[model samples]
Target chain A: GQQVQQSPASLVLQEGENAELQCNFSSTATRLQWFYQRPGGSLVSLLSNPSGTKHTGRLTSTTVTKERRGSLHISSSQITDSGTYLCAMERSSSFSKLVFGQGTSLSVVP
Target chain B: SVLLYQKPNRDICQSGTSLKIQCVADSQVVSMFWYQQFQEQSLMLMATANEGSEATYESGFTKDKFPISRPNLTFSTLTVNNARPGDSSIYFCSSSLGGETLYFGSGTRLTVL
Candidate 1:
């Protein structure tokens, strides 16, 4: 079975501070996606990056396929950013099936 | 991106009763996936549904316990048989359209007593 590991299980940051989240996979993945879930809410896709670096607004995702690792960076974090960030990977053989990491909980304070 | 609409945003049922959750995709998709999430936990893959075919369940999930149907490409259903208190959890419906990114529904929160 494939496994995804997320670092910094939880993080707290002051508003305007920067946050960095890490994700590592146990096996080769064909696809990697980042998701944000608010308390008692559904997951919202943040970024989908299997390799290289991608940016959307103040959020950036970088993935190194050969190393089986990925990272998400948030600049000037805001209070609305408080939530759980999850990383999911789809193995090369599994097609659309995704294996999720434990997730990194982020709390931003003013 | 496909938008998934799930019915019965929340449900409360007595033990031993059966529960069914419906998921409808706005556009046609190749497959639909069902995932379970416990309180403060990550998502767990339950099964994969394809049109006109029997769903492929993951380990520890049985067809008798959780039966899935994909009669068409735009619709699917999941039924939990003989529900128990332990069955209380959030169930999410998701699908991807020929890409890596997946779109998810709001999810159904089930509480069994």
Candidate 2:
């Protein structure tokens, strides 16, 4: 069984629209990070949201430690935002060893 | 800022052949991780590399199939031995300095035929 799971395997949104991606973990996470991966490319760090809410530009991430859930909100989606979003978390006792989710593939259309 | 770089962006190898992927970090890091992704799918952890000791491989992965060496704090190498079609995938090397965020390299795309 996967420790971290992402919702809405795929999403399609129009430009200027807002979209939310969800991540649920079966175990408690001491650290959580969000990443974006373009088609045929590497994964890039988007936000490090261990707990509470964090906002940067038009992207916001909220993580609920107790509930073992995390959410990433994208506002005014752009074409460049079309990619796969992944959520990864690490256990408290681990030395930053991360377990990744399946990821949500999002496409922003004009 | 921590940056990781991988060598041989892409390569095509014959079956049973071997290939080596290198990961270098801009600064000294404690640990590095190797991951494999197939067809833009979910990433699977292959192994964890640390300086001055043998690499730790995850279940379903063997040191004989994928040998990892951490010569120093800032450099590591992963070698895929006796490659097969199943070995084809994009390999990424990542490291976290002091934070939980793992910074990944550009990744090496391997095609085994």
Best model number under TM-score: 1
Write the residue-wise lDDT of candidate 1 on A59-87 in tens digits. Answer: 99999999999999999999999999999
Q: For every candidate, what is the interface RMSD in angstroms?
A: 1.4, 1.8
Error of 1 at A110 (Å): 0.7
lDDT of 2 by residue, A1-110 (tens): 54899998999999999999999999878867899999888888899877899998999999998999999999999999999999888775454357889899999999
**Candidate 1 chain A minimal-lDDT segment of 10 residues:** A90-99
Per-residue alpha-carbon lDDT of model 2 for B1-113, expressed as tens digits? Answer: 68999999999999999999999999999989999999857888888899999999888999999999999999999999999999999999998877646789999999999
- Pairs in steric clash, model 2: none
Assess each prediction's global lDDT (C-alpha) against the native.
0.92, 0.90
Q: Give the TM-score of candidate 1.
A: 0.96
Q: List runs of model 1 lying over 4 Å from the truth.
A: A93-95
TM-score of each: 0.96, 0.95
- Clash count for each candidate, listed in order shown: 0, 0
- Report, to 2 decimal places, the DockQ of model 1: 0.74
lDDT of 1 at A10: 98
Q: Evaluate model 1: give its lDDT.
A: 0.92
- Which whole-number lDDT from 0 to 100 does residue B19 have in model 1? 91
